[model samples]
Target: MSGTAELAIDAAFAARLFDELAARTGDAPGITRAAYGEGEQIAHDMMIREAQALGLTHRIDPAGNLYLTYEGRDPALKPWVVGSHLDSVPHGGNFDGAAGVIAGLCAVRALIEAGLRPRRSITVMAIRAEESNWFPLSYLGSRAALGLLPAESLSTPRSDTGLSLRAHMSRLGLDPARVGVGQVHLDPAELHGFIELHIEQGPVLEAAQVPVGFVTGIAGSFRYRAARILGEWGHSGAVPRGHRHDAVFALADLITALDRLWGEVLEGGESATITFGEIGTDPALHGFSKVPGEAGFCLDVRSPSPACLERIHAGLLHIVAGIEAARGVRFNLGARSGSAPARLDEALRARLAAVAEGCGAGFTELASGAGHDTAVFANAGVPAALVFLRNQNGSHNPDEAMEMADFAVGADILARLLARDDND
Candidate 1:
């Protein structure tokens, strides 16, 4: 272990805490800590206990974000915050959200053990409701913390229990109305920078044999919720190929066109990804004997470059138009949900790179395919960055392998970065 790791991170403690939380929340498939549910609440309570044990003062923000604060020499200075969420997707791995929070806590623990005080406070926060699986929202806690999400989003009904997020909060004894408006607990202006350490959640680092990686930016994405194709219902066998306006066939053509568009996007030397996560015909109208009258699907497109995203989107629209004319079907690409790309602070990246080098930790720079809470802060002009720890078996599933050594190295890097008073 390097000086930072030795002084700042308690690797054993972090590992133990991870195991304890996993055991408490683990189920047959994987860990289950639904947002605002029993598991999430238990995880939060455990975090509070740990913070108290470390002699740190903790508070719950109006948005239900838990912040454990290690006071610094100047309490009024904007805090350098580091943390990740505690809630998990259904059947998610133990380390997905938990590792980041534990890493932040361990980093702070190391600093306290070393009896070091920086110019600004360091806060470790375990954010809530990062996974959209529970509710129809992503980054709810972070966005609400920043006052970026609308108040109406709080009242949006969850898919599982058919209760609004507000109702769920009420069940947890939190005021939903108060939670929607951010800045009640901590001002966004009071944040110096944000650092989130998360499992790679992909095979990139493992394949490259790197222990850690720095995120360049978060991918911007476009989502179509009700993309549909309308055609006349007819017999599957009796309808002639030329006479039938088959919706399913039109959907297939659209997918093929999108794939061609994807090829063109690659030819332009821009990275882009498109997914048709859902495709279905109306069950009442769709049968083995009938030609499908209507089809519905969801399209998700993402890219690190806004230009590339728009380029692909334009291609999609063009394909829809062409398909509609060729197949005699009406294509309805419904309302889109869009988020612009967020680039990490270059200065902060430089600092992290230097710190990682000093710690002798092997690292590489990459852009995150998945979105994170860091993007919300970074988009709002805050200095925000992500550090990805190596993991196997991917994330949002069981058997997510995050070795303690790798976890310690990541914590060491973050601790050293936070320990710096160079800019202050």
Candidate 2:
């Protein structure tokens, strides 16, 4: 253990930051930090101001990812990067993405206040556009920084504004062309490791009665955002059951079949999740007395196991074929988008676990069901670890509640980890 283990995390600093964030970005029902929008800009600016106050060097990439570095004894060693994204889902809780960034700041602040600098620098990152609700892309800022995002994605439009990503970057005076050409800002090989501290976003930590969790892996997903089922419309009273070709009934059959497959997968001791997040018929065309002719839906399937993901996808195709043949419906599954599962660095995880144990913070190992920017780093060949703070009422909603005490415990662990000398 490092001498900084005796130093306490600056939790008060984190509280003030969180309160200020909520006040400035509050969106009535909750907070709305739209990706690359005004609210998100406010967050980045705030982080910059805080970095300036801490006397840390700051830099911004072409994609507007923020990096604030606290200098250490050695300038040549690869820095330890700590951070998470700053954008949130529409009307989302205040803590979902912001907590991780704040935790990074808190950890760095603690080290600085203790008058101790380790061998390698510590960089607190503020990633952007993590909420796919705004940009329809995964790990937008992180991928851009690591030069992993495809050039075609630059033309993808924001959901609410319908403006291309390139246009948005230009609006903020950022170089979209550089990002599109795969300019690297934070190279994976130049970092010692990456650590992200985020809220649990689920009941797992709370149920386990632990204040924090060390994540083992993050779930990958396959998504169909604009799938549709088409069939002939007819009068409900006139169409016989055998003769009717109903799109709604066909959708129902598809859902039932998928549900059965999901249950079977679970019974087989495999982990997977299937969700029909959005499903409905066209309100303008359908009537109460009419048999629906068309229905649209979106599907999101996730699993930590790549083989399991493939198995489920295969079952879905088979089920869709049978449903189409029996109901005489045409299925149009739109462009598929997804990411592969990520495995965290086991050695780094063990080190953090030891640090947490030394700090007397209760923690357990688990796998994350939600996607995060940490997965981007792990996929880029960087050693990465994710720490989850206990939160209540789930996440991506206004009711999410993470205790400040729990956050302090997590931050303390991070501070201890960063304050240790490389030789130790």
Candidate 3:
């Protein structure tokens, strides 16, 4: 138990937690743990039960963020906080955010089983509402905990329920009044460091046949969730091609323009991704015989470079203007929301790589194209690091296939990192 090879993770415990989560929150195609909803509450309650069983002290913040701490021998040192969000997208795979919290819990369990106490306490945080699909805001729970969430954000409505964030918090018996006042539950200066373990959510590690990855940085994003195009509805057979003002055609033009712009950006030695995730015509207002007069869509753009984001945004505006003038349509893009790109802690990343090597875990250094709560922590100057475990079939879907063995490797690295006494 003293050597790196002997350190072990409680995989059985992790498995039970995962199984229970999927069983309780199971939707049709996959699992659904909506942020600040019933499913997410089930996951949080499960974690609380497990923490109590592990003899850990637990606390819940006003924003409904849960923290479970395993005390160390020393009281003066800043504790290491390890975890990710518990909420998932609609019909999303179970392992996306849950893996990080389970990994943290397993790491602490390993130390306790080995009869070793580190100098700094270890706290596993189960963050609320990381999925922007539920709420339009990015990194909602993390930003609120850090006191960086704007007061106006409290009035933003949840997409599904159409309830304001403040109202939702009240439903959960949480203190939204305190949350709106910019109260800080987690101060950056008081933390030793933050570590988040998540599924790769892409094909990088899977294609490379690697078990894990230490992220160098995370991409920032700008999203318009309630964008719409408006035109006049007319008879399909009666309206001439030139005289028609079709919203569907206008949307198509916009998509095509953005795709071309995305390619140009890539060709110019810039990295960026643009996605139109949701697009459709209103079922209640439209008919097969009539030209569609309105369409709603969502736009998401991400890049690690701030300049790239701005350039694409400008391109988008230009495209919108051209389409409006030509198609005789009006574009109404609702309130814009986004997050800044984050550069993780290089020193902590190096230390993790060393630990991975020492533990015989295969790892590679890469940049994350997907957004994560780790970005929030790093941008807040918390010395954060994101560890990605290899998975198949991508993420945010029903087919996310993360092997238990790969999870163990990532958990082992976390355990070893937290078990060490010396702080670099």
Model 1, span 131-202: residue lDDT tens? 876775667888877777778788777767888998988888787777666444556677899999999988
Q: Give lDDT tens digits, candidate 3, residues 185-260.
A: 9999999999999999889998889999999999999999889999989999999999988999999999999999
Weakest lDDT window of 10 consecutive positions for candidate 2: 1-10
Off by over 4 Å in 1: 1-8, 181-184, 282-285
Worst 10 residues of 3 by lDDT: 1-10
Clash statistics: count for each candidate? 2, 0, 0
| Residues 1-424, model 2: lDDT tens digits | 3567457777789999999999999997999999999989999999999999989999999999999999878879999999998898989999998999999988888888887788898999999899887877888999999998899999999999999999999999999999999999988999999999999988999999999999999999998988999998999999998888899999999899999999999999999999999999999999999998999999999999999999999999999999999999999998999888999999999999998888788999999989999999998999999999999889999888999999999998898888888523
* RMSD (Å) per prediction: 2.3, 1.1, 1.4
Whole-structure CA lDDT of model 1: 0.86
Candidate whose lDDT is highest = 3
Q: Which scores higher on TM-score, 1 or 2?
A: 2
The true-versus-predicted C-alpha distance at residue 353 of model 3, in Å, is: 0.5
Better of 1 and 3 by TM-score: 3
